[model samples]
Target: MAVTVISLVVAFLYGGPQALFLCVILGILEVSLSFDNAVINATVLRRMSEFWQRIFLTVGILIAVFGMRLVFPLAIVWIASGLGPIAALDLALNPPPDGAAYFPNGDPSYETLITDAHPQIAAFGGMFLLMLFLHFILEDREIKWLEWLERPLAKAGKLEQLEVVVATALLLITATVIAPDDKVSTVMIAGALGMITYIAVNGLGEMFHVPEEGEEPEGGPSGLAKATGKAGFFLFLYLEVLDASFSFDGVIGAFAITSDPIIIALGLGFIGAMFVRSITIFLVRKGTLSDYVYLEHGAHWAIGALALILLYSIGTHVPEVITGLVGVALIGAALGSSIYRNRKIAAREGEDAVKTSIP
Candidate 1:
């Protein structure tokens, strides 16, 4: 397929076997870390026509390469410069760069750039995701508060997740107001920007969302397919965003092993994404979710662990490998349990069938 060719082309541009290896490794790692995201995304994909599903994967590629692998580091650099000097030092000390692009003309050591940027990226990503997850958790799923408010406006769409994001923004603003006027403001600003991004992306999803029945019900997204569709799309969107967050550590950490940013990006971008996509397909085709009750439970636990790692990465340096291992262990345990459960259920069903035959 075109995607496969493009992935290889990108890898070739980065150059070398090491680049290929890293791309494969990081891609696999990303997919594994984000299994829950894939499952959740599938829920949305089910609603979309086959055409839309392909679009998701294609757009997803763009997000990973341009947003996470490329622009994100620069954004983090901006955040670091805006914060204090010590923050930058903390980030830079970890690793050195392999090479430099033409625009900069100088191959600033990875260690130096990271240290200069400060490690606040970890906090920015961690807290931002944490808040988004919490909003989903706390939102009034049972009641349509937005529907009531929109009665006068005659809006057909329910409030959706927009309220949760706004609430998060408000909370960040409050924190900004209460904190000391110096560095806290900078951190708060970063957090706010993160939330704003969430709003922007989710808004795009809503805008592009082509619900059946042409218009959503007064309550919005009713029925199993509709509900799962929206949730899954949001889940997919969140996963991509989450993957972007996870990549910060992976890309930065790649330098500790090698200095080439091209290699780092290629390694972490294409191969990593492919592995995850393959896993996602397997899970979907096999009906892993339906077959194993606790699979989702395990994935959420991994998500939580990754979130913690992201938060900790702010003040303390946590290796990307450690984060990957923790997630793998959790998901592995879940898969094992699922196997045992399926066997037990099969045995019970066999017994019942035997008894009926005897009669």
Candidate 2:
């Protein structure tokens, strides 16, 4: 409700049907690019409780709008500038010559320009996304390179941290191997930021005094409701995070078409994200993932493709539309397959019912 009202106000304030149309087009684009995110998010959201869902819808917006929309672009600018946060602040306040070029057309040419102006940060974000995709692929498979270390760690009951340490080390190594020529320091900084964010969100959640609803006395139904709520909140946060990451390309790509920041943020931020959120919720309620087997699998595959697009953007150019359309096609195929499976099941059930009656 608040988001809607705020969007309305912004729309009116930024008046002109052009803004509204941009909003509509960008909204469609954003939803299309991140549709897979919605499906995967459902996997986590299913575990959350109703109360948490509301918090997610509310607080989650803050994280998306402020954190992703505002901070992320600034972060890129800071890293690219190779300046401290203070220096970055100065640059933001007092524009440098042609800083306007950064937001060209609606795409942040920071990546292309960063290749010239701030290559390091661009490389870092690309490498980071690549590592994440690779790590995801590895986790899905069962390769035990750590069996020897795992044995000793498990004996001491401290294997989980060891696994994390190993993963972190691996990512760092990958980043180092592919360190960008122009922005090595920037890449390192970006990598640190990403790591810090993960630790703060996940680790703090564990260390904090946020009490899990205490064990119900006398075996009363546990406040599984609260737990579910927390889960839902986390799921919502996950969706926001996923949305932000997915939109980075679109936001940057929009610049390829136009140089208007107002249009970029206004068009993409409000319109694109809303439709995506609605479609995600509709699918969740409909249990599309479960009913349409392999949808999650397809979405994940799309994520992998997007990650590649980001990485490729590091070396050469790839159109945002290409990346988005690829994702849509993959997910669409999954949905189509699911429909076929559902129909087949229905037909089988009907046949069985008829056979039983005949007998």
Candidate 3:
């Protein structure tokens, strides 16, 4: 809260009331879009040690703010536009004049350059997130939220490397059929890298993870496992990458609100990212997921929707609100279901108590 106040005050001092207002809107937008992210983050974070959680809030946030939101976009522009580092930074700070062509002429703005590179960015983020969703849904779990659908997917999970095979096939189809001819290579490469990253990080975590005595080996991504040592490191890395994937679309969409990178950083990166970190920590500490059983399911479903949205975005434009709303809607339904189930359980317990008391 203090950070938000300071941030808005700084914005006002720097760019007047308009900047302050934009910052607030961007911060709100980021929070709304990433509520599911907080839930998912809590899942992995719960498995992490307190020290690691502190590192996540501090060091990890630095990476999210500057690494992903600020520097990464600048790097994207530099690569796409073939500009010097200093020049790229400058172009980003001072985009094209207000009335000129929006993209790719003699002097394209940073937004244009980065937007042109969207195919690769989307592919990479999309494939990674898709793998996450697939790993969760396809794995056999004792608990099932959408039993009708999850049960079948769990049975299919018995097939070795089924998730990988499915993910690969989707990537290939998106690259060859959905993506433009000129962009096929970039899409394939980026999407492949996304797949490889997920496999490596998740695989490393799973390989090093040691279940406690009598504990059944987890069949899913192993996020439920309280990993330590090398496994913990990989889990931390996985969380960071997951954060980057979730932030990719937001970082880009912020341009639509304000071209100023500083405001984008203040709104989307600092205030917004801080809130998400806080929310994750709160959820972990409170063990809310244990009470609301369907949240994780809802979050993963939202992730699947987001992954497909990102992949589809490579070919065409999607309203940013749609992405956020999809997540909100799925998670909302899950929360409702959880409440209903909890009430039903309580009622049954009450009835049993009455019968026992009468006897």
Candidate 4:
């Protein structure tokens, strides 16, 4: 309620009632596009301590809403345009000049600036997300979803830093083949930084992870032991990066609705982000992932799909609706599979109990 009210007020202040409507629409669009992000976030957030969870809800909200939605875009524009922060803000608020090539159809707008930087942004976000998906799929786990593909990847995981190698190869191929000649360097650098950022943050998380004294380190450490103070901090960083990677697509897609940065922030930030955070908390508290065992598998697969879409988007424009639908479909299918598997298990257990009673 507070988020809706605040969003309404912000929209009104930015551009009257019409702006309010657009803001609401953008908010809905963001929520629809990012539902999978909420699921993935819940998976990680469930591992952190209560204190870290609270911080994610409170402090993290501030960063997601303001840092990523507002300041991040402005920072991008500033760096790309070589404008001062104030000038960039002004550029964002006002329309573009006549005959400006950056603005599509000669319409000067902040969206133009953001659109112009899409290649680099897409490269960075795509590589980071791709690496994340690879890490999840390649790691040896008890539950295997697509065994035919994942099993081989799990075997390959035996090779040292194989995920990193695969990700680097993909980045190089993308830059060399798909990216335009003029933008090749920019794409390569951005993609490399994305991979580096993932490795650094992931390493930091592992470094801080302290296994419990008596627990066997099967997969490094027990969840409880791994959620220490320092580990939680690094986990927080991981979640933030994950959120940022998801937001790259959302932010770029928001332009399809409207170019006003304020409206985009009000829509995506106040409403969409608040909803995602709430969903994450709800899933954590309810243990949704545990109940639906395959849900995590589905989410990771969705992430893999999304990562590919982000990478392909660098070469061509993919509609936001298509991206959202693909994720939703994967998650929905996973839920169905989980339900089916649960029913089968219950039936088998019932039959066993009946046979024992007869004997």
Q: Highest TM-score, which number?
A: 3
By summed lDDT, which 10 consecutive residues of candidate 2 come out lowest? 204-213
Q: Cα deviation in Å at residue 131, candidate 3?
A: 0.4
> What are the per-residue Cα lDDT tens digits for candidate 3 across 132-210?
9999999998788899999999999999999889999999999998899999999999999999999988887677674
lDDT of 4 by residue, 254-354 (tens): 87777777888889988888888898999889989888888888888998898889888888899998998999999999899889888999999999999
In candidate 3, where is summed lDDT lowest over 10 consecutive residues? 220-229
On a 0 to 1 TM-score scale, where does candidate 1 land against the true structure?
0.65
Model 1: runs farther than 4 Å from truth? 1-32, 35-37, 75-111, 115-118, 132-185, 192-239
User: In terms of lDDT, which candidate is strongest?
Assistant: 3
| lDDT digits (tens) for residues 148-195 of candidate 2 | 543443454333444346436644553565445564565566656654
Q: What Cα-based lDDT does every candidate model obtain?
A: 0.57, 0.56, 0.87, 0.85
Tens-place lDDT per residue, model 1, 153-225, is 2232245655455446544543455333454655566656666776676665665454543446445545344
The reply for model 2, stretches above 4 Å from the true place, is 1-18, 75-180, 188-237
lDDT of 3: 0.87
Question: For each candidate, C-alpha RMSD in Å?
Answer: 9.2, 7.7, 3.1, 3.0
TM-score of 2: 0.68
Q: Evaluate residue 97 in candidate 1 and report its C-alpha lDDT on the 0 to 100 scale.
A: 40
Q: What lDDT does candidate 1 reach at residue 234?
A: 62
RMSD of 3: 3.1
